[model samples]
Target: MTAPRLKIFSGNANRPLAEEICKAIGVPLGEATVTKFPDGESFVKINENIRGQDVFIMQSTCTPTNHHLMELLIMIDAARRASANRITAVIPFYGYARQDRKDQPRVPITAKLVANLIVAAGATRILTMDLHSQQIQGFFDIPVDHLFASPVFFEHVEKIGMRDKNLVVVSPDVGGMKMAAAYATLMGSALGMVWKKRTSATTVESVNVVGDVDGKDVLLVDDITETAGTLINAAKVMRAHGALSVRAAVSHALLSPIAYDRLKGGEIDELITTNTIPVDPRGLPITVLSVAGLLGEAILRIHNNESVTGLFKVKGF
Candidate 1:
């Protein structure tokens, strides 16, 4: 039997990344009309027929989170109603991911709620990269294709020849030790960590560095950074410990105004992140890598019913 036709579409959010993914996959983006109404309501219309076609809607729930999310839901609903064979919501940056659990009383697990909403909105599956919490996969009943940007970062590591130098991978906090360890192992570098305390929503205090970073170039790895408090504080601690230089590789950089302000302070020598969300470096020492190829490959594999295990492997480039 032949595979169903593949049709890729994009919402208003992160359309540039979606276009890049389409380019990588050698496919044209589907035609759709996504707009807003006078009352500030989302409106969606499919310009072409997609009946019996496998549909993938690419949208990152980034800035103006609710607007992008609603657009995604509406697009999925439109595809389902239009008789698409299957629909996959490709979210490069899954927002509200930080609220995966209820750490305190009277707080809602918004991440789970978002998962439920996606499932309820007629998404047959989901494809996302570097979720804030890995456990968010369990929240959905449908299959979730979780991809990582580590391969992209590893490529950058090779491009800069960091693999040949004395290097250490540092986690910004204890919770991110596993991610740091993976990076360190892949790069053949030592592992370190910074103990941090969250003083407020936008402030983090880095208490101490766990491993020796003296005279070594440091790479701080984290899943996501918004205000950059954790990264800046951790970089400061690493430098104070006699590290020659401090750099960071984060999966997602949801940089706000405060983050840009902090970056100007020279706490870190460079900040490497993915194009999962829209980011502007503002002439700062920030590098944005595109994950479109990685995501495009997974989309092709998933559509072909082939194994996607190789996407996780980090081979020397």
Candidate 2:
């Protein structure tokens, strides 16, 4: 029998990234109308028939998180009702991921709740990147293809010749030590960490550095940054420790107004991140790398029933 046709649709959250992914895959983005009704409720209409075809819907639960999340769920339901053979939710930036655990009294595990919603809406699989916590994958009963932004970051670091510098990969917090260590090992650099205490939801107090950063260029690696509190505090501490320069390689940059102000404070020389969600550099020393090709390749591999492990391989490493 002939293989099912591949169709990729996108919600309003990150249409440009979806378009770029379609470009990389050499396919046109599936036609869809995603909008709000007169009452501001989410609405989705699949313009084309997807019966017996493999369907993928791309959406990032970023700013206006609730609205985007609703759009994704509605889109998935539409595809399922349309009799699509398979439905994949391509969420480059999965929101509510930090709420995976009930850290507070009478709190909810919203991440798991979101997972259940997606599965209930008929998404057979999930394709996401750089979750706040890796264990979030277990929240889903379906297969999850969790991709990392490290390969993309590695290529950029090498291209910019930063890999050859006297570099040390530093985790902005103890919680991110594993990710920092992986980057350090892959880049053949030293590893460091910053001990910090959360002062508030939008602030952090970096207490001390765990490893030597003196006379070395420090690269702080973290999974996400919103108000830029953790990163700025870490950079300041690294500078005080006599580091030559401070840079940050964050996977997702959900920059808020305060984040832009802190980033402009110049504690960090450069901020490197992915276009998982929409990012506006505003002419700062920020570099936004496209993961479209990476995601596009994964989509193709999934449609073809192949392993996506090879995408993790960085050149010359």
Candidate 3:
């Protein structure tokens, strides 16, 4: 099959990541103007001709989530109107994923609504990583490429020499057991879980630990963390249970001010995460790993009509 001409663009959200992806793929970043008007409206202009080209717009719906989301929609519309052959929305961090279901009364499923909006805006495909819930893929009618950050995390873990140490993978809550299990299985380590109760939106109370973590180096895995409550509280409980050290590997670290304060309490030794969204560690023991190479490779394969299943395969497993 003939590979289509590829063009990559970036919005205000995480432009550095998009540049890194272009560097990894050995392609020049596409020229585009994504700006805001004085009235707070998003304006997008595709500076280069994308006619019959395969276009990918990279944007993470992170801080100022609605604004970034609107920029992506406008970019998609611009690409479609410019006669692009295929337009893919490369969202490293998919915002609003946590609202995938209608669990409360008089509430909307915002994730589904966002999916509908993307389809309506003329996005032919979606490439995103570490969604808050797996079911969010079903919300889209178009082709959605859901990627995991396990490979990136595993590479870093290996580099940090954590593989040979007596390690235990832990989930901060029962809901994250599947992710923790995947990490434990890949690393050939023991598994543990912290049963947590949410008292409020930003507060989590870790009640107990479920498995053996005594004197073991604990690695807590979670999809995303905005408040640091779950991870910090879990680390505290694990330490109380005789854990030697506690570190967290979260896919998206959308740290707020309160999160920084909680992190300074010294419950966790290190906070490892992906650069899916822009993160400023503020001199903390936070290690931000890049997923650009993974995403760039996936983009190349997708544009060339190749399989991307190999991207999920971990080495130690």
Candidate 4:
């Protein structure tokens, strides 16, 4: 069997996560410098030889989204120029994914554009998790190892064990019901949803709940949380209608300043999230489960040309 040449690198998007993934994989993060110029242009320098090596660059296009994304693209281009055997862009929380299609007049499919940019930058593979839409995987011409945060949250929550927690998993909007139903099945709970209207780009107002959350502990699940308007509004309504407690499990906890304010103001009891997006609740009652191990294991499997399907078997075990 041929030996594996696994190397991981990171952009400024989430360096801490990259470090943890490197630790789990037991490999030094490939040496690279991702900096910006005076005009905020991205510059990447690969300081090591990755020729013939299987390379994975860990970068999440979170806040400062464009800069981080450009950094990733530049890094991939550099690796390709250096003759790396393969390059995988391991995006944790793929931004620009929400605009996967052009539904409006004279609109651009930004998600497809990002896909083109990555491929053009010479990314041979893609590994991402909890995409806004699973269909986004098909947006890539190359292979996409789409993963989930269920294992991370399930293991952590199951270990602690919820109390009297007959639950109703909640979707803050119609778009998220499928994800909410999946969580309900995994947790052996009921399913519910909040009908919401987007009042603004960062605000969503909950108008009604289609299912029962009354007197039940709620597990509101979604793929992302930006300003927390929708989440907070849902929780507020549930409480008014007799929800015992409103706990949340989001794949990406982008807990913005307003989100933290909402969570701190007694809008949510427990917030379970992954490290896909850097969100520090400043030691609040938020539980952050590291997905580094999950990503690391997947990277190993991909490098060895192994099936990554089993990663979901035991929650990335």
Candidate 5:
């Protein structure tokens, strides 16, 4: 026998999620101690030896983003020095991915920079879900597994049952039309777009609506929603254009202060998203589905050296 190969570890960010993933994968979470010092510096120590073992570290850089990211780097570095055979960063949500490109001069390509940091920290591979940009996958020199949360989201939407074939998948802006179009094709519905102009970080103005949305149940699709400006603006336009009901499906909900403030006022009917970030479904008008099971399955297959292409399918959606 080649011997048992997988060892899963988690940093301080989302241990509850890590444990859930471990349960799905049929493995115990590797013991590790992560803490902060008085000066607010990070400290990490692997409680169990991982020599010659394939180590997967689960850490989502959400909330206290920089601190969690640093913990992941430290853990990976520790794994490398501990002689782990291969270290795969199982980042269900990659932070700093929105800065994948510089539309203007003097801005840093932060997504690529984060990739370099992972490589420098001795991570052999990366696995993440629904990045802000697909091209971010190319930023890595090491192999990357880019998974999508669509299958999980589609399952919920399919169960709740859409109203009719007249459903329209609306993209909040031109940049997200590709994802929206895919949803449209999957649902056997039409596609539409809202013309928006961003005024500032947390503010936007809706200019116009493209294509037909009259008397259709609208599904607004986007990769992330931090400030809720884009989503609120788009939903307003979609509703004004005679959309019967407007619901949104977002992959990540970084729902900042402004987002929470505005979203609580009820612009969109139901906001569906994955728990790639910290989620509290209790108070908000949003519903969070666990991607833990999906991510867990992918991690198990990766550990066994099995094909993960199967995770990327839904014949209908």
Candidate 6:
């Protein structure tokens, strides 16, 4: 028996990342037409034959979330109908991930719903990174390859000499303590957290800090950031507590206009993030690292039936 050929396609969400991934894999990106109709309905047509081939669709459900998500689903459906042997959805940034639970009355778990939609669209596997919540993988009945941007962040942190700057890793909120602790452990830095109360849907107030950060170079870590309220507020609190410098390392940076304004307020000295979503720095102190090599390697491993566990190993100094 022969192995099925691997093909990769991209939606309008993050085509550049997809192209870079293909470059890393040394394969040409599968040709496809993914666009919206005049009525705003998505249309996808596989330009090349993919019958009996393993297919991967790369799309980030970022800004214009619903449109990009719909585009991904449509593309997956197209690949399935093309008789592809296997279909994998590569979502670098999974939108609606924050709505994974029913914290309020009569609200839907949109994250689970999104997962169902993908599986129903005939995706046999899922590849995503730094989801807002870990349990979102449980919503899917298929195999899920959950990757983290920490290793990539760690490499950059070392490159910039942040590892030896009296570094202390702090979670902007209690919910992200685990991720922060992992970074602290790997970097051999002190671990801390900020207790915050959500004043509104878009605002957050930092109540207290859990660990010592005085006179230390603080690094705030989180899986996602949109309005930047939580991070900026936490950085302010860290500075108020006598921290020498404050920086942020977020996996997904869905920076909005308000986030830009807050970032410019100087609470955070540098914002390090991944290119999971489209980010516009607008002349701020933002560093965007490409995860193409990381994702591309994972795609190849998946196609070749290899373990992706090795991708998680970050070299510590």
TM-score for each predicted model, relative to the true structure: 0.98, 0.99, 0.98, 0.95, 0.97, 0.98
lDDT of 1: 0.93
Mark the 10 consecutive residues where model 3 has the least summed lDDT.
Answer: 156-165
- For candidate 4, lDDT tens digit of each residue in 138-237? 8889999999888887887677765235778889889999988887777777789999888788888889987777778888889988888888999998
Once all C-alphas are superposed, what RMSD does model 4 give against the true structure? 1.9
Q: What is the lDDT of candidate 2?
A: 0.95
Off by over 4 Å in 6: none
Question: What order do you get sorting by lDDT, best first?
Answer: 2, 6, 3, 1, 5, 4
Candidate that beats the other on lDDT, 3 or 4, i.e. the better one:
3
* Clashes found in each candidate (C-alpha, N, C closer than 3 A): 0, 0, 0, 0, 0, 0
lDDT of 5 by residue, 83-185 (tens): 9999999998899998999989999999999999999999999999989999999999998999988888778877888736878899999999999988787
Clashing pairs in 5: none
Off by more than 4 A, model 5: 315-317
Q: What clash count does candidate 4 reach?
A: 0
RMSD of each: 1.1, 0.8, 1.1, 1.9, 1.3, 1.0
Of 2 and 3, which scores higher on TM-score?
Answer: 2
Candidate 3, residues 1-317, lDDT tens digits: the string is 65579999999999999999999989999999899899999999999989889999999999899999999999999999999999999999999999988798999999999999999999999999999999999999999999999999999889988875599999999999999999998888999999999999999989999999888999999999999999999999999999998999999999999999999999999999999999999999999999999999999999998988999998746
Clashing pairs in 3: none
Model number with the top lDDT: 2
Model 6, 1-317: lDDT tens per residue?
77899999999989999999999989999999988889999999999999999999999999999999999999999999999999999999999999999998999999999999999999999999998988999999999999999889998888988897499999999899999999999999999999999999889999999899998999999999999999999999999899999999999999999999999899999999999998889999999999999999999999999999999998743
lDDT value, residue 111 of candidate 4:
93
How many clashes would you count in candidate 5?
0
lDDT of each: 0.93, 0.95, 0.94, 0.88, 0.89, 0.94
Candidate closer to the true structure by lDDT (higher is better), 1 or 4: 1
